[model samples]
Target: MNSKLVILGGGAAGVLIAMKLASQNIDVTLIDSKTFYEYTPALCSVLYEETDAKFHQHFSEISFELEPFLRKINVEFILGNAKLIKDDKVFIHQREEGIEYDYLVICTGSSYADPWKTQNGTECIDLNRRINFLNEQREKYKQAQHILCIGGGPVGVEVATEISYRAPGKKITLVDMNKTVLANAPDGIGNNAQRILNARDSITSIMEQSASQKGQEGNTYIYETDKSHTEIKADLVYNCIGVTPNSEFLQANHADWLNEKKQIIVDPGLRVTSNVFAVGDVNSVNEPKMFYTAHMQAIHFVRNMSRIIKNNTNVENLIPYHPSRPNMIVSMGPQYAIGYVSGIKLTGWPLGLNKGSHLASWGKYTIERITMNSCHLKIPVNEVLYLTSRP
Candidate 1:
């Protein structure tokens, strides 16, 4: 029998690897709890003024049936949560048995709480439904005279600006422990965001303050700040805090390969061991925890894995990862955005229209197409609307 290659997580990295290996007639099995892959860029963009029809179309378009796609690619799909990993074996709680493997690749990425970044496929669908319901409640959002947003991260800033765009008259209070918005970003980018945010009477930016939820009462939320015992009351609240790496499965083993925060440590070529590799957000690689980075790692790992399969891969020849600056387009609204690429800061309508528009969705879509094609799976044109592409 052929040596079995078992992959955990059907995320961008895992899916790409499965597609490449399965199409080449290698014995590969993919395990993931998510029914479909998510194009997160679109998710972030939708907080603006995306119509109901547009949201539905994009959500459905970005995610394809995970099981069917993998099966079509000749990769076995296992719809179960992975529980633990021993040397050369994986224990899945649902199966109640350990499965052996000649090689293992883990790509279980990170997640956010609630409406942010959900962990599994079921949670994703539930969140989508909630978003739909949330859309219906936009009236409530607008009716709320004051809105409090906790955390000044990308998502937090995006939500603040999006709310500012949709309901210009609504009061928005964006609070972060950092002294400035996008504190980790280039100084000019953060400064620019502050200028734009400050220019609006409806928006207020609070720095060096952390808030704790004081519970909700009659659709009203109360937050207490650390400094000055400030009490900020608002009608609606969004929590965009941090990325929690999905490495609970590794905790049981006291996995020395993981940091105290549970992020897996990977070698230069993105390997945990000679026969085991770790890619994407789950790994503590130098790269940012973004989908595109995972996709790129997938390509690099598979090329080396292909050589390994053919007994021509030299360990020394394996590609080492070099982290780069994250190029991002952060839209304050549908028509305006702020961005930075290679130390060059750009802000305007054109960047928003191109990189932050539905056109940007097409770029992610193309990557998904290439991934699915690698797996020998033909995503029907109907499955791919103008804005969604998936593996």
Candidate 2:
């Protein structure tokens, strides 16, 4: 009989693992709350202008139907939540018998503060709803003259830049509690991002300030800054503040398996228990929480799983995973970007070009294409120039 392997969360790590294990003798089953896999790295670009040379695309364009994609690779896809994990049996919503697995992998990723990351409490049921919701947000943003973005991380900075590029007249206020944007990153990256944001006419960088929403009065929402005690009013607001792990299902029964941040505690081999494993952002791994890092973890997990299966469920021979510092790139807009690679700081444009002519988008797009292609999906380069375009 084939070894039964069940994976939770159809994000980057889980999907890649299923794809790799499909060709093996293991009977792989992937369970996710959502029906599709979203390329979340490009999600902020959905606010970009609708032009021939645009960075943003419709949600359906970036997302792939998880059920069909997994089916094509001989992996069974289940659309439900993993409600409980007891012994060797995993119980899900609406499924009574539960699934018995020789091995279980938890790759449930993090949830963002924005609705685009999750709608209502879970993912949107299908693609049309996601598209409609994104369209509504775009229309609301277009109508608003003033917008407030709370956070200085990659998502916040990227959203601000996209709005500035799409509509230069809109007043965009970026507030961060830190002294500089990208504070967790290297000093050079933070300084570069600060300079880029400062150069934009429509963007106002308000550092070392925390804003709390007081209330909304008609079209304008009111906020109070913690440091200055000054009032900030905006027509639209994005709470790009925190990332919460989607590991609530583990809380009831397996509380000891999670850390204080609710991330699953894994061993050197990425195992939560003898028969269970966790990877990606959901695990308490000491690595940068980037999409590519999650991919690396997934690949490592595959190798260990292969060993465990070959040794007749013996994990003693499993290889340990060691994480290295990952390279990161952040785009200020379509024209500019900054990156950190191999302990070297990089400008968006390689040849010491002006700040506004950064080709960081080129690298970002290339990474996006590579990620999509790994899952057997190729982005068509018909109207959108994949290589030469700045975005």
Candidate 3:
């Protein structure tokens, strides 16, 4: 029996699944708050425009209209806030009727920072508008004697490196409560990142101290760290810390499926319920919530879904979900980046080999390969199922 599949996110996972399933002529619907998708990997590069003329040129490439993309793949795109999830149905605000589905895939991602950067990477035009302001702020920051970045996470480190490349001679300070940069990653990752970043003469990093408070007074910005009443002053501040899950809607109804962190918990096959499954950051998978990992889970889920849709009797042959290997590509500047793949560091020649570069040639390639979005995917069931289940 064919089924109406509804996916409740427009992130890497949701979009890839929907596009793949839709290409197979499956009835699919994708719901998101925005009409477009923002390619987040390219977001940091948007600020490092090669020429003044091409300031907004890359914005188009980084973010694009989802409606047309979905249309091309034969999936329906609905723009609205998903406010609730009930028995086999999703409730959307500003819509008179609810959408019901035979199978539901929840991929709603997580986000961090003020003004809340949705992990889904939607609200395209709106984000471009904000980036414009950041461009202006970048100009202002270029003139400031000192700048304070209050996180050593990806965003903070990326922006700091970008500034070091774009606007040298200005001081950039990064503060994080962790012992090192990218603390969640492997020890080598954080240590190597710290070594590269601190190598810059103008950059300063403060670790193991939590930012207690931040406020602006007149022309100066103030940040107080938790220990020793440490006060740091700067002309501007960027808070690039913390992530809040976008799983509140599920809590109101499917509370039992959520963990203590409010993240959706799922079985080995990523199933939340009999006909409900989850992928990406919204789910409590024991792995880093990254675009690559999400897309991997999407492929896994879609392949198994194809099997289930084909024959339910071979349930044991359904491939199990596993956490992707711990890998990271942190762009340091336009020409350099810190990347680790399967515990092996990627560096040297071929400018696009690693994560850094305005071209993002390699990142884009990996994304395209991982997505397989528009491909008509079919699974060969009863296969070896040799994939292991750990990072």
Please give the clash total of every predicted structure, in order.
Answer: 0, 1, 0
lDDT of model 3 at position 4? 90
Residue 290's lDDT in candidate 2? 75
Candidates' lDDT values, in order? 0.69, 0.78, 0.71
For candidate 3, lDDT tens digit of each residue in 1-391?
Answer: 4579999988778887876688563589999876667666655556556554565766554566788878987888888777788878898775868898988999888876633254333233345565666577546655687888888988888878877877787788888888888887653666667776777887888889877557878778888888856788888677787676788776677789899988899888898888889998888888887776777788789888888776663544557787776767777876667666556565433443333443333643444333333243212110111143234
Model 3 gets an lDDT of 0.71
Position 68, candidate 1: lDDT: 76
Q: Write the per-residue lDDT of candidate 1 for residues 1-391, one digit (tens) a residue.
A: 5778898988777887886677663699888765566556545555444466665665665556787777777888877777889868888766777888988889888877545555543232333554565465554554677888888877777777777776788889989998778777653577666666776677888889899987778878888988866888898787878788888888788378798768888888888877788888889887567666677677667777887777756666686766544655555655556766445566543444322344323433454455445354432321232113221
Model 3 segments beyond 4 Å from truth?
50-52, 114-116, 119-145, 313-318, 347-391
What's model 2's lDDT at 127? 65
- Candidates sorted by TM-score, descending order? 2, 3, 1
What lDDT, from 0 to 1, does candidate 2 have? Answer: 0.78
**What's every prediction's RMSD, in angstroms?**
5.8, 5.2, 4.7
What is candidate 3's CA lDDT for residue 175?
88
Which candidate tops lDDT? Answer: 2
lDDT of 2 by residue, 31-113 (tens): 88788888888777755656523423445456889988898889999887878799798888757888889899999888887
Model 1: lDDT of residue 377: 44
